[model samples]
Target: MGSLRTCSRSACERAAVATLTFVYSDSTAVLGPLATYAEPHCYDLCTSHAERLTVPRGWEVVRLALPTTPQEPHPDDLVALVNAVREAATDRNQDTGPGVRGSKGTLEPPAGAGAGGARRGHLRILREQ
Candidate 1:
């Protein structure tokens, strides 16, 4: 049997056969050898952390460039990647304020004023000028 190891990350204390391997570029940990595993490679982690395992802060995750086989990527992978990119784009947009192009126009209030107040509905059309 292979020797057991613990996660090198300071906050973790999981024991497993394989410790996460990191590659260094210049003075930084640039990537990992086991980053793209379809399942949790390490053991003893809670469900949440195990599900979201990846290269830590300051490490640039290097994706595997292997040729794709007949099998397609898992749906979970597509969802995770898309969600990550969306979150990153949102963060960048918030910081930069909608990029080179100005506002895509403004959001105006609904056309008709409600009797007492605005009645919340499923779909409300904005009155854009």
Candidate 2:
């Protein structure tokens, strides 16, 4: 059996055997092995960093599972399905209007537009004379 491995995050020094691996643009790290282990969904977490975890932005801890018999969609089939979905989404987002100019247009208003042409309230509101 493989020995427990420590978290790769510089701030953390926790031991983990089956860890939910996080693969970012530049680095890969583990979350935890957990006390009560399970296949694919161990709920163990690092108490120290629990409060700091912000979903979608900060560290995303996942449960590690043991290798099991492969089931469901085949690899090639899954790849094809993903490609199809991506292509569909891209097509939906593409500009069907005039030309390249329409392609540059955004779905929402530009940054500075305010509600009812009112100045942004967050900025300092000068009292009218």
The global Cα lDDT (0 to 1) of model 1 is: 0.43
Tell me the RMSD of model 2 versus the true structure. 18.6
TM-score of each: 0.24, 0.21
Q: lDDT tens digits, residues 1-129, model 2?
A: 222434434666664333344467535345543444344442233444432444464545453453332223358986897679657646755746435543533233345655443343353322323
Best by TM-score: 1
User: Cα deviation of 99 in candidate 1 (Å)?
Assistant: 5.3
What is residue 120's positional error in candidate 1, in angstroms?
A: 35
Q: Flag regions of model 1 displaced more than 4 Å.
A: 1-72, 99-129
lDDT by residue (tens digit), candidate 1, 20-115 = 334455323222232234245333322234345576576664333322222335789879986796577667666667544643222334456554
Best by lDDT: 2
Of candidate 2, the 10-residue stretch with the lowest lDDT total is: 120-129
